[model samples]
Target: MLEYLPILYSIFLVISLCSSIILLIPKVSLNYVRIHIGVLTLPPLVALLALIFHVDNIIWGPLHFNTLTWLMAVFVLTVGLIVQRFSVHFLVGDRSYRQYFSLLTLTTAAGSLAWLSDDLRLLLICWGTTLLGLTLTIRLKKEWQVAKKAASTMGRYFTISWFVLLAAILWLTQTTGYWQLSQVMTQDSLALLETWEKTCINLLLVISVLIPAGQWPFQRWILDSAVAPTPISAVMHAGIVNAGGILLTLFAPLFNGSIAQIPLLILASVSVLIGTGIMFVQVDYKRQLVGSTIAQMGFMLIQCALGAYIAAIIHAVLHGLFKSTLFLQAGSALHHDQPLKKSKKPASFIGKFSGIMFGILAAIGFWAASPEDAYQLISAIILGFSVSFAWMQLIVFGHGRIGRISGLILFIAGALVYGLVHTGFHHLLHETIGTGAQPSIPAFLCLMFILFIGSAIGLWLSRNRTSRGFTILYLWLVQLGEPNQAAVESHPKYLTQYMSQGGKKDEFSINIK
Candidate 1:
């Protein structure tokens, strides 16, 4: 039993890949979805059973049966079962059902491989394949416009994440002269490198991990790809988002050094705040779900950074189960033409006041949780408050006047809080220092004032506006600039010149003569 664990996973991967191929055959019926789900479910379940059967031996290996890994395994299995059930009902009689199931099998296999992989090369291969499977799944939507846009966005995200991972792997090989996870885990060579070299390597690794976790700047892809079918979204959030945490966990030994761990922790904490902030502003249920997943992934990374491996894994697993259930339910709601139900009665003033008081207490609790200096603590607190407010406002407003005002208020509050925190911690103001420093009073005040002015302008523009308020708010937060502006500015001239020169007929393709 002890010797067969790796072999079991390998066999499962082969069978899953084969099943994915078989699903592509035209002769295969939609019932193949069930079959594919069954195939996908076996590896993780069997692995757990194997571990149980050989508990002593399993616990003795490099991959010990820790609480985190066990919890993660259970969560993955639970999600797989839930997704399987949901797919059976939602995908019945659908034309692309087989294709959907095929991609799911691939994703499941990749996820399992990632979880069980103790080798870097195998892990990277599985990671890339999982991403590819997800991209293909996203493209399966019936609407050409939706599918095309989603595919494009997913493609960009997949490419960037893979590129970052590749660079990190290359750097690891060059510096440590090894690409194996077990080897990297054992090697302390990273500590021997100069501070700058170590910093560069750690930065690359953090970026590589972050891109897939849907950290900001690259997070739009997660939202865009949510246009994919329900189960795919669930799997992407529950299974794929956990990949970075798994990688970080496996490389835990490398992070024992203070220099290595501190920078990574800082980065992860920043991602957590950013992801949480973005999540609060999204109006669409799917996007909200995606944002929540991204935020949770960031939290997982932060746990790993703090060397709380078990805590991170536990959180990741629980998060996956809850998120998967929510996504599946949301999909069902969307399919049934049911809007999210709203509370009928307005809260009494006392209730609202109590809620605000609770929120302030919670903010203070979080501030107490921080390990940073006064400045960093205050900055984090303000950022957290701002995000929480923005999220609440978005939920309450839901694309109307209330939402715009609430969003504007949240933004102003966030800016002001940030400014205050910055100024209170750091004495200097006015000049933006390149290095990380304590927040200063003047800087905090300036940030608040600027943000308040901006919010006022945004609120003014949104009143009785035809455009979507939630979307506008998101654009302001993510800095996506303007939507459809490029097409408006350049498309007509390009189209006219190409048409005059007798270019290709396809609209999606460039029509150079």
Candidate 2:
């Protein structure tokens, strides 16, 4: 019965994809399609539960029904289902409403299929289809020239990433003599190739993943993508940008201990800092969220670099759920009608001292738990730093003694929740996801120490408003976080063209508002 889940999951997704095509029919009942897609999405989530109990990984035809693949399949489809359901009402009467749902569902289903597939050929086809579907979905609001420009920019990046991935896949299969990804990535197959060959292929794979994850040098697309509708932004952030972590986890064996990991680490680390700057500097709500995503993705990739594949997957899943919710609630972020109140400011001298002390203790405790592991050392620094930040922001800075106490309690509870969630995912995925090649301790410790000092110095400098370097850095971040000129509009010039072209009533109704 457990073995049959792969077949059943595929059937459910296939049926959903085909049914979405029916949604493209103008006369079809959109609500009916909504129910159909939503209902179909639930089965995969259920399938995930069953896979949790089934310890052995099953290769049912093209799919390797491991917990990792099944979990991701459930995640992507769940995000798609949410986005589609939200769009059903949110985008009503707008032009291309039906088309949006169809393409979204197509993209989601194809993405699920790609992961479930073990055959390299099937993965390529489904992966390509997913990209195409997303590209088209981004263009759904074609009447908006800005949206079209965003879609065009996205398409170009997707093409480049896809090609790089294709090249890597072809090279791997040709060298290993196996079209099956499960086989091609195995230690025996990897040993068949020379060291240089594996490194080159891994490098190519890294390049491909970076492009889609919105890492530095390739992140302009995500900033430009703010011109898209909120739901589109949600799906892009939630499902598509997670590709880097997913792909990296899948190919962790090939990536582990490769020299390529060093470059990936460097690039991703830079992206994290840059993304942090962008998030802080950006005024636009959507762009702020975009920056946050870039930062989050960088962290995910960083986890992958350290051979913590399962942890990276956990990050991707949580980030998707949290980021998608933020995007969907973007409109609510700025409540213009709400009264601006000046609240009592907290006494922060004591708070800052307390926070710093707590942070140091937390860092030491975390490091003690995994003193020998390079990745865990980094993780400890991050966790401790995060706890300190949260402690200061929530408890130390609370309005009064009572408020501070409440916040302190809440903070502890939140920590416990995080620990539980992390532990659960670790146990669940440990069997299917292998730990990749461990990184060198001396290199990571030295690198982290330098980075920590640099960050401290940078923060101190940033506080000096009169410094030329500070001003230049601030402006650079603001500019980087800004949307492209093509994606910006003083007015909907398309409105005039749309009206002139005699666009339909319903479309005009939404546009005129």
Candidate 3:
């Protein structure tokens, strides 16, 4: 029965594809399609619970099912169901409404299969299909030239990323004499490669993941893609951007002692800083979300660099949940945001001190709890800082004592929730994502120090915003977050066609102002 699970999951994927094709029919009731797709997502999630007590990896032909596979399947399919269900009504009356659902289903199903693939060739094909599906969805609004340009940019980058991954896989297969990802990474086969061969392969692998994850230079593609439909943006940011961490986790063994770690750490650090800056500087709602995705993906990659694959998986899944919800409600956010901006003044020195103190206490507590685990130490410091930042902004800096008190309560509740969730994930993935890839303690500490230094510099600059350095950094981040000119327009081009089709004369005759 367990052996058939892989086949059963493939059947689900096939059904999803067939359903998507049916969705293209003009007469099909979208309500029925929404119900069907949403229901389809339930079985996989329910099936995952059964696997909680069954831990062994299942393999059949080109596919493999394990803890991580099940987890990602749950993520992609769940997000797909939500986005499609929401779009059924949310996108009503749009020109390409039908095509949107079809493309989204295709992308989601293909992405789900990609991670389950055991053969590198199969993974490449499935992942490529996913990327192609996403590109088409972005270009669905063909009436808008900006949308077309954005789609084109994404297509080009995705193409490069796909083929670079292909090249890396082919190189490894040729060297290790196996196309199966699991077999290729086996100790005996991995030992077949010279140190330089392993390093080159890892570097190429890093580049491929970087483009999709939208770190640093490659981030422009995602920033441009903000012009896509809301559901598309949600799935892309919430599901697809997390692909980097997933890829790295699957290939963790390759980076056991590779030099690629240096570049990976450096680039991801830069991406984190730039992404954070972009998030702070951008006022556009969707663009701000995209910036946060960039930074979140950077942190995911950093977790991968630290050889904490399980932690990265947890981060990806949680971030996807929150970011997707934000994107779903993005329509109302433009109106709802005015209420969230009540605290306009800078946080006081006492607020800053309290935040830092809390961070120190949190780090010490975590370290004392688990002094033997180096990864936990690094994780503790990062999470501690995050807690401090949140406390300062949400609790300490508020204008009213009631609001601050309310925030403090919510903050503690959030921490409890996070702790419970993290423990659950660790139990699920710790065995699957092995901790064999340890890092040099001294080097890792040095990298952490540099990261903290960068954070400190940013903090100092935020205080003295009128300084030339701050001004230069602020303008640079703004410029970085700005989409390409071709991808930006005064208004949606489809509006003209819509009005031309049928609109009240008054709306059509309104003054140009």
Candidate with best lDDT: 3
List residue ranges in candidate 2 displaced over 4 A: 339-349, 441-450, 497-513
TM-scores for all candidates: the values are 0.64, 0.94, 0.92
RMSD of candidates 1 onward, in order: 12.1, 2.6, 4.1
By TM-score, is 1 or 3 better?
3
The number of clashing residue pairs in model 1 is: 6
Question: lDDT at 508 for candidate 3?
Answer: 18
Cα lDDT tens digits, model 1, 276-297, are 5556666667766776776688
Q: Is candidate 2 or 3 superior in lDDT? A: 3
Among all windows of ten consecutive residues in candidate 1, which has the lowest summed lDDT?
Answer: 427-436
- Looking at model 3, the pairs that clash are none
For candidate 3, lDDT tens digit of each residue in 343-380? 37867888889999998898888888867766778878
Local distance difference test, candidate 1: 0.61
For candidate 2, lDDT tens digit of each residue in 98-202?
Answer: 788778878888888888789988998999999888888878767788989988998999999999999999999998999988898888999998999988998
TM-score of 2: 0.94
Off by over 4 Å in 1: 1-5, 51-74, 141-143, 256-281, 331-513
Evaluation by TM-score, superior candidate among 1 and 2: 2
| Residue pairs in candidate 2 whose N, alpha carbon or C atoms collide under 3 angstroms | none
lDDT of 3 at 489: 96
